[model samples]
Target: MFSYSILLIAALCGAATSDPSTSTDLLWPLPNGNTVGSDMYSLDSKTFMFVPAGKGGSSDVLKEALERYMKLIFLPSPVPALASSITAPMDKLTVTVDSSDETLALNTDNSYMLDTSMSMLSAKTVYGALKGLETFSQLVSTNSMGQFQVPSFKANDVPSFLYRGFMIDTSRHFLEMKTIMDHLDAMAYSKFNVLHWHIVDDQSFPYTSIAFPAMSVKGAYDQNHIYSQDDIAQVIKYAKYRGIRVVVEFDTPGHTQSWGKGIPNLLTPCYANDKPTGTYGPINPTLDSTWTFLHTFFTEIARVFPDSYIHLGGDEVSFLCWESNPDIQKWMKMMNYTNYAQLEQYYETKLLELVKTIGKQYVVWQEIFDNKLEVLPDTVIHVWKGGDNWPKEVYNITKAGLKTLLSSCWYLNYISYGEDWPKYYQCDPLAFNGTAEQQALVVGGEACIWAEYVDSTNFLPRTWPRAGAIAERLWSKTDFSDLHSATTRLHNHRCRLIVRGIPAQPPSGPSFCPHEWEE
Candidate 1:
């Protein structure tokens, strides 16, 4: 029992404090408006009321306001329904959200938290208060069946780490704009704040390059596979509105097969054949003209992407190609370099310095650290290998005074045998044994879904719920819940994903539930 106007007016109120002895009956209120506010139950009076706030505000902000409001008034913890069946008075409560734009706004005590990024997430991503609207939807509704009871609990949640990221590799397979947008919504709902767009690689170059149109023409699978400059701009605009940062990547040297397709001389020949190596092996890092080409390419990228970090991929470069080339070998001895690793170090350092000249930050795989080169100021190192070996690398890199982003525990491409959700959940960003200084340098982690095994068809079901585990790890404290409860909750989360248009099948095999049958 809340009056509609009273509920809407007290949007900023806190939760209730009531006696535990008496049990009050809470029913699923009839859905009335497009917008819904949290229930108002006064602790002192022991009366319950439902209010329908107008729909279409930042769900995150709305949830926060309501959560704070609920803390003052005692009531069962709110759980958003997968779909809103609320009728009549609640018809006005449905908020129309823009799943593509990047700006998200919510007021906490009248203070605004606005996200300005390139790809905005939907309420599902919980990019901000907009996702909070889902909480609001469930707060006013009671359990349809008595199997689930809303509990009375208090929770104080803020992001545990700052740079929660998700990367989309467009090089191997070219995904449609809608597919990318759907993921943006999903990531935001899961509270991910960074979108690492791996735009180009050796396999293919899907980006439309103005300075090098030949790159797209030669490397892209087709004209449709390429993302026009305007398309990229649109994605950036949408992400920013949802408070998501977009980090653009151009994997150089090793993963530059397509780059070689665009510029033939930039590639290194095979060690024995002296013939084109295609997209495989080491690239011609010793070429002066290569640096000139990179300078122009990166300069253009810097002008387009607003994020501080630019990923110059420095992984998987073969040593034979560089060590065998007569010109490279001559240059290495003349430059007083000892081996191939040092030569790679020279290339990485020069590229990093070139990026620095443009006034942007640098991020590369752990290989850069393995090279033992002098650290660039404020560089971010991403750890991708599995287990202790990778974790140890993160420790060493961060201890040496560089920030780190963890991808070791979050590779979604590893696909679940039964369900990998538990394994992903138990991963601790600060779990390794290290000094306080080393721990502090571990910035955050990301859940990555490399495209080798995924496509638009099954990507959502495979990623979600498991990715949700990573989202919680990134957003909540280290010592959260155990795997059992997380698995159970994941079973229920399937319902929520369906409501958000995600094709997530039920956990208990495809045949257990009819909802899993949906295409």
Candidate 2:
């Protein structure tokens, strides 16, 4: 806390500095390859064509992206026309995409080239073109002449990592569908391609499973809190259109408090004096019905979520309950399993195998590896343990040939005063001393803001600009250092987010938006 105080005090002194929309700073997740022009330019009839190139054809996806962006580009309403025409207003703006495949995946390309001088953007995919349009929208600001101005520049950019993830836990506190969509827009604007949704946890179950009608009804905070099948489909469709993948997590074995509410006889009973005490623990692994239930549940999940990977959380299994259950102990003894870890391994193995049978890969917490569980090759291990030695953990995991996503330092839920984002921006996945092959195994990283203390009311203001730092950290090819220029640039970027209606709180100590979030 004392350490963060120093950084926060530093932010207090380094408030408002520059408007990032200016030619000098003109972008967020600053383009990897850029050539900035000295002057700003205005456009003519304010229409941008979002089109496909080569053999690709038009679709509703492109039309939706263009329509949404046009409003963002001309935010606050129609820009009043000048009484007298100014010099060289462009008549058209267009972006051509090479691929019409809008199905986003682990390998989907988001590389784009933006030539503001030609009023054109080109990309290998519509996702990339969408990214370009976002950058172009960020470039809109009034010049000294009080007219819509844009910088003439060329930007060739590609994400440094394949997966730039932002995770939100809906179980801790249910977020409305509108709130989720708002964050999707914000995530896309920041070039983050993944939404690692910790959808259900010990606290609540908000995902209304189609096969299990009782789950949400019994486990959710209330009937109104559930994310209906339509809600889930809309979220998937919305995120896909924005080039973001939604990876849903249902933490198991432990974190099953909510699961117990819906499914009777699923959890292991806590015994007192050899009698059933009525209190239950994690799913009973010894029960064949447990496996059957999961097989049926995840079969439905696989069909519902089209993503290739599902986050089957294998973290923080409580030994207290397992140790308390004599039946589990007797089953363990019969199987010659000496420790609770061995029992956990049995459960995880069965679950992972079940997911594979349904033709879906899995992502687990680092605990699965710590427990010596043998996972399939496609498993994405999400590393979440914190400490200075996290780099060593990543090195070891990648050295073992398992692909992973780093979230050790980007836990936004662990709030501290001051510019904490600098630390977040500093924690690079590739900074570890590992071989090129091991480093390549680093898919990307995620900034997780758990929802125990976060919700719709304050999620925006509390997360924002700090999360933006994470956005740049994962998206840009720049090294993980918070430079002096980056401070001002990020501060400016905060203002950019505010105008775009994200309500990003100040990453710096204090700041003002040129155009406030409301208008």
Best by TM-score: 2
Compute the lDDT for candidate 1: 0.60
Q: What is the lDDT of residue 115 in candidate 2?
A: 86
Off by over 4 Å in 1: 1-155, 273-280, 507-519
Candidate 1, residues 119-171: lDDT per residue as tens digits? 11123233434433323323332232312122221122346677788888888
C-alpha lDDT values of all predictions: 0.60, 0.79
lDDT of 2: 0.79
TM-score per candidate, in order? 0.74, 0.92
Write the residue-wise lDDT of candidate 2 on 1-519 in tens digits: 001011122345665244333344546788778786644566543443444454333746677887887677666311211222233565556768787677778888889898887778888888888888888887775543556666667889888989899999999998888889989988987889999889998888998988888998999999988898999999999998888999988899889899989998788888877788888888899988888899999999998899998999888888877888988988989999989888888889889888999999888999997777888888888899957788988988898899999999898888877778888888788888999999999999999999989889888778787888888888887553546767766766776677677888877676554566672
- lDDT for 185 (candidate 2): 82
lDDT of 1 at 312: 80
Q: What are the C-alpha RMSDs, in order, of all predicted structures? A: 10.3, 5.4
Residue 16 in model 1: lDDT: 21
